[model samples]
Target chain A: MNVFVIGIGLIGGSMVKDLRSLYDDIKIFGLDVNKAHAEKALSLGLIDAQTDYDELKKADVVIVSIPVDVQLEVLPKVLDHIDDDTVVMDVGSTKLKVCNVVKDHPKRRNFLATHPIAGTEFSGPEAAINGLFKGKTNIICEVEKTAFKLQEKALKIFADLGMRIRYMDPVAHDKHIAYVSHLSHISSFMLGKTVIEKEKNERDIFDMAGSGFESTVRLAKSSPAMWTPIFKQNKENVIETLEEYIMNLEHFKQLMIDDNFEKIFEEMQDTNHIKEILNGIIVNA
Target chain B: MNVFVIGIGLIGGSMVKDLRSLYDDIKIFGLDVNKAHAEKALSLGLIDAQTDYDELKKADVVIVSIPVDVQLEVLPKVLDHIDDDTVVMDVGSTKLKVCNVVKDHPKRRNFLATHPIAGTEFSGPEAAINGLFKGKTNIICEVEKTAFKLQEKALKIFADLGMRIRYMDPVAHDKHIAYVSHLSHISSFMLGKTVIEKEKNERDIFDMAGSGFESTVRLAKSSPAMWTPIFKQNKENVIETLEEYIMNLEHFKQLMIDDNFEKIFEEMQDTNHIKEILNGIIVNA
Candidate 1:
């Protein structure tokens, strides 16, 4: 099988590593707008060669693994160049915009809109590792719109990579993902900003940070280029979730101000349900 | 030296395990309100025996590692019973309340109030592990009130355990910790609550939680009993920090609602300072 991957950053690079490990005979071609990242991916042996969108016609599968903003811009162009038999997919975090943009494409049936629910705080080719997607869920949005054979091929590939596939409408995917994923990134980034703004002494943060703070702030290190578009693409859902999150924080703050120990304790205990929810998911770390 | 640890849960049990490895000949006694926890600590070899509060008087050093509310209730009584030569210390997240409670004690000089900025979401004797405190900061509050010899003895123990010592006033410690530590816990717990409440299907969370959501919500699994009191004791500071956190989230939400891409992108980029601060700390996992 031949796979042509664009972006060649963390997710794209990691997919190359994991896929190559699974099928040594597979040919992987990398593409990136950043020349340094493309060269780094090649030197890291993440791909057989650096290729252009024009060469995507020969690929058995072409993956748009770039930042969400770029994915919207380049996905249709890449699809236009791919052969009718080739399967096209994207691993962008936001799906509604990308799905709508490519809805009227001539070969729209060949494209499978997916958001593989897996990643680390790190980015770029150097951050890629084998088994990055193992046991993680992959949300396939607007799957019914894709050609039956192409959808089957994409599902098989994800299955081979040890991913559990979940189907949803593009709008639903964006809304739920905003609550579960995008909002987390924003919360972490702002928390990091608040701490830095208030605690100007970096030494104090380094000295005082425990595992709790480290884990909570981990996503703050994620690529701004990647997340900014996601927040923009899923703006409505993100806004709704962020409003609820702020309201919850405000209510908790009022409880604390009132010295309402009973209420605070009850709130924390109620939220502790995350233990059970988290236990169900396999943490990649 | 003889060391007695009360409340053999996560922090206390970890302390015992780490201290035992540092001081081979040290005589250690464990005590807990929960008999099963004490028994488990003993079985795990975290201490030489499951002992009583009275046993603390015989020890050269006593560590009251319990919940903040319990610490405030018990630490002063523990001080009353300890020998003049014995150094007593309580390792609780909030220090101001505990310090003020024991301020007028006859043996106030024998007590050293410290907060070791290290922990995991999991609690109980089973969660204890060796080297949990290594390379972490041990914040000592109101050190001037502690006897010079007692402070020296506590410093040696922390040094032996490979922890860095930092000094702060109890009031300042509570304030800074509210932002850095307490707010992280509250944010995580509330995030978990908001998502769990929004997504009626718990299975959605299990299916879609990526590394980012997992890291941000990790502290939601913390023991409610342990954290409830810390929030209560540091209510004023926690409320202030929570207000700031909510205000920041609200501002970000407005930007998202208005589709202010530039502002949102800039905000996230600004928060990337966490990468530098985190780089300075040793993240265990």
Candidate 2:
């Protein structure tokens, strides 16, 4: 009944909260490269104790909750240190590289590749709060590769956390994620950059930024340390999605330049279907 | 005192809520080209009464809250009907065109061109709520042209609504708003379009759209009826900003294709400053 969470940031710390709430007998341990985050998680009562690499062997379950590049670095090590009965899982943004990194490991059957699609723009342990995963989707890739017993344990945990699980191939998961998630970060980050570069008046930006600007640029606040590797690992799919996204912007911009207000209106009216689609995405409190 | 609110959409109806709370013995009249919206405003108590074109003359002050295209069509007429003592202010997204259209009118001094940087993605009377402008910025343009006495009354109204006012020239207002407001809608509308075109699985879009995608594309839900005229009125500025935005995206895409991870990371890190900037923009509850 022991769970050791590696790199305890927003996702890891939030997961630890839900796990403890679900199982009274479970003891949770956390390890973070960020000493400040580790201390904060402890002060926030997010973990039972701070464990190290040496004590990582004592856990029945190990969750790799770090950036993708770091996950590629430490996941094999975690699998090597754990016992045969231990269940190892990772919640990384990009899955293809991580899945391939451990594809030939002897203990790969005990490993699970998952991405729980939830988080705010903020990062680190202080950003963690209860119910981050509630009613969110958890994408499990190559679930068939995992041992049946360990998969059952992970599924039970997600169910207890109030999540709906969707199974997909690792490649498909990364591609769709590039379109739905990574492109948004890039679009948002660049939007912030373009406006910042032109609008020299900082006070004016602050004064005139409506909720729409706030929402559009919110992801620009995401952690650079976390995102750099994600963009690197999923480079091809990310590039393809970026091209399509840029082309769409260019097309819309051309319409604006042509003073084709009617066409622009029609295109935007077509895109308004996202309202109906997003309603299913956002669960109200 | 009397205040006549034309259009009766999100901005107009929300303003009515605040005016009632901030003023005593002030009668508010609502008008809309759409009968259903006018009726909805009345039922929601957003307006004291549904006013007609004939009744617009009885106002001591008038708020011409409508779409920009309609503002161009009807603003002069509203000015023609109001007395010299009445202050006719507009809450349109664009300023230059509206300011230009009425520049030579005999009652020009009676009209004040203002753009309040406030609103949610949803529109119409039902979308109206209390305190939409509280702690938000209100941009008053061409103040020199507005009568000194009338400017005093308008300033008092903005202050009573818990807004901090910033004044700029009409041309400057449209240019800055093109970058800070209208450009955001274009970015968001296209982002939604790009992602929607790629992911045919509506259920997948529903499941995969995290708060990041939701935040980035939130403006896609905005009413086309309202935004069409905004782009048309601010055509040159919107086109300029849109071109810059598209170029930024193209540059980012090239870096991604070149696998220039370091440059991409640095760019995102720089834009991360927006997080700090946005804190000043959003007023927390």
Question: What tens digits encode model 1's per-residue C-alpha lDDT throughout B247-274?
Answer: 7888888887777889888888888878
lDDT of 1 at B48: 88
Scored against the true structure, residue B121 in model 2 reaches a CA lDDT of: 95
Error of 2 at A45 (Å): 2.6
Q: Count steric clashes of candidate 2.
A: 0
User: What is the C-alpha lDDT profile of model 2 across B1-285, one tens digit per residue?
Assistant: 899999888898899888988788989898889999999998988888988778777898898888889888798998888888999999988888899999999999999999888999989888889999988889898999999999999999998998888888888888888888888898889889988999988877887778889989999999998999888888889889988988898888788778898998899999999987898786431
* Worst lDDT 10-window in candidate 2 chain B: B276-285
Instruction: Put down candidate 1 lDDT per residue, A180-259, tens digits, no spaces.
Output: 99888888988887788889887778777787888898999988888888888887888889889888888887777788
lDDT of 1 at B164: 86
lDDT (Cα atoms) of all candidates against the true structure? 0.87, 0.89
